[model samples]
Target: MTDTCVVVPTIREWECVRDYVANAREYGHLDRLFFVLVTEDFCDTDGMREMLEEEGVEGRVFDGEAREQWYEARGIEEYGDLIPAASHAETSFGLLYLWAHERFDFGVFIDDDTLPHDTDYFGQHYRNLEHTGETLAVESDERWVNVLYRNVEEHGLYPRGYPYSAMDEEVGETTEQVDHVVASQGLWTNVPDLDAVRILMDGDLQGQAQTRTTREDYGEDFVAATGNYLTVCSMNLAFRREVVPAFYQLPMDDNPWDVGRFDDIWSGVFLKRAADLMGHHVYNGTPLCEHNKAPRSTFGDLNNEVPALELNEHVWHIADDAGEDAESYAEAFGAMADALVADDTDYINDEFLTFVGEHMNRWLNCLDAIETGEPLAEPTPADD
Candidate 1:
């Protein structure tokens, strides 16, 4: 039987973590739930593992050792420690570790606080992948699918990376659809999904009120949007094994941007652009889950999200321009990364491209090393 490797990143949200696993178990989705507790330097890995065992959740805990060793094997020991404990984006590295070492057809990501309200949560995501390219007639094609989620107040929420501009836009009304899709996103409920900006603007600390949301529900349907603005959060997102490497490139320490915040958003944009070039679609909307947001300050969220409100649009524009005539997703993605570094003065000195280049090379080396059970050749340093 095929199974999904469920990835979760956390610092100290233990109870929520327990509930997350319990919900899946209750729904009978725990059989293959590889509940990874991606903790930081300060978090107690032993305690975290104990908690999971107590809750009967099966999985692994990553605390940078494997990542460090992998990078060291590639002769970039200094870069191995680049993943920051201050930000949660290091979780991407943890997931990449699993992808390199384990065998799984799909990888599923869910926040520690999110829970499955229905018994078929995993099945829903599985079916989406199974039918990714199914076309009912000559005019129809299914690519990416998003599972919807509601928050504590019964208000529909958009994923963190979801574009506010595209929130009101229908799938094919103003946007264009691609022939295939590389990834799918699931939405949240109660807190329904909202970016840090929206959460800040609304000032709903309690998440107690149900605000009317756009494109909130598409009953039992897998939908895709044609606009450049649509994006997905890692909270309830899944990708095919082949697509993981494309989105796996996380911003370890690239700055002027928050390490924790925009990693997934920018990666989603990169993946979307690549998917589009590959004749694939990126979609969002059903297999609903619940996002009972924990209480936090709007100011804190604003601090983290304000940059993306401007940069995400800029990122997509760069990807689109760079993607013209691109032969493959890798080519398109590389060109986009280069352009991102070129256009922005702040990014020029950031060594963003160099890090990305090294990261990708290291990933390739790591994958090869894992398969052969031997250390791979050293990675060639990218041009400075």
Candidate 2:
């Protein structure tokens, strides 16, 4: 049996967390499944742990302080800096820490607002990761595959972070190929993951309507070819342990520009580029979940996303081009980071790029420390 850990980052009430735990227990592999709940700094860690204990669920709840303590005890305080407080990306820390210490075979990430359907959510992801037969491969003229295409009831909707330039490109054609699967992306019913702009324009902003449900017969899991990319929403995602080092989930919400919410999309782009170069595959469609999306200000979301809209168009392309010669996930990611820092694009912010690049390298270093079971050395003043 494959050991798996489910990581959820939430700021919701205990009732929401309890419901997700119950659903996972009902539909997922209970014995092999461990849960990791990451909450904001303001959330009560002790209360959360007590609730989980009362529910008899095997898991740990981490807030900012707990995360810091974990790193401090290991003498790797610098690593904790990679994950910001009050961000969905906190699960990245949970996943990486577990992989480095507890040693799970796979990590599954879901939003707190989501619940499992009658399907075997965890089992399907495990099977997809273990699949070795010929799987569907998509070839697109636009070098991108909107994974949401034909999979959702909505006709014109695309997944968040999908480039607007490629919105009109037909899905092209599908063929069959054999490859090793590294990541599996599941679909969601009720509410599909979309950018704020889309939600403002066409979505049921109040969550009062069920519009973006997944189509029943959406066909088998599919992957884009080496030169193409897919929009990977982290909310219903699972991936092999080997992919963790490449999937940092890019930290957000604490930056100066107020730009946020592209963390998963950008992380997915990096992972896909690295997976392509490393000769691994990422599959989409299976183990669907119901996203009972929590209500939020759509306009606020738009404000957070505005700055990255233009950057999204060209950033993944930069990753693809930068990672072409890489042979490993780490190398591919590092190459992309270097490219981001070196980019002279007008819309790209130099300071932000520098921060991102530095953190990318720092993330790799943290992985290295975990692999070696040694605390990362404190940086010298000059190094800082």
User: Which one wins on lDDT?
Assistant: 2
- lDDT by residue (1-384, candidate 1, tens digit) is 325677777775655667656666666767766666676657777787777778776666666564455556744555454356546566666555556544576788777777766546776676666554443211111222223332213544455665454443322222343355456677666665556666645656543223544334444344444324445678778777666545754664445445336667777767776776677765565566677667666567666666446554445666667756777655666676567656643432244444554554454444445556553642221110
- Residues 192-284, model 2: lDDT tens digits: 788887776774565223346564636667777767898989888888888887898887777887668888998999999999888888888
Worst 10 residues of 1 by lDDT: 136-145
Query: Best by TM-score, which number?
Result: 2
Q: What lDDT does each candidate get?
A: 0.57, 0.77
Backbone clash pairs in model 1 (N, Cα, C under 3 Å; residues 3+ apart or in different chains), count:
29
- TM-score of each prediction: 0.75, 0.91
| Runs of candidate 2 exceeding 4 Å displacement | 13-28, 151-154, 203-210, 348-350, 374-384
The root-mean-square deviation over C-alpha atoms between each candidate and the true structure, in angstroms, is: 6.9, 4.8
Query: CA lDDT of 207 in candidate 1?
Result: 31
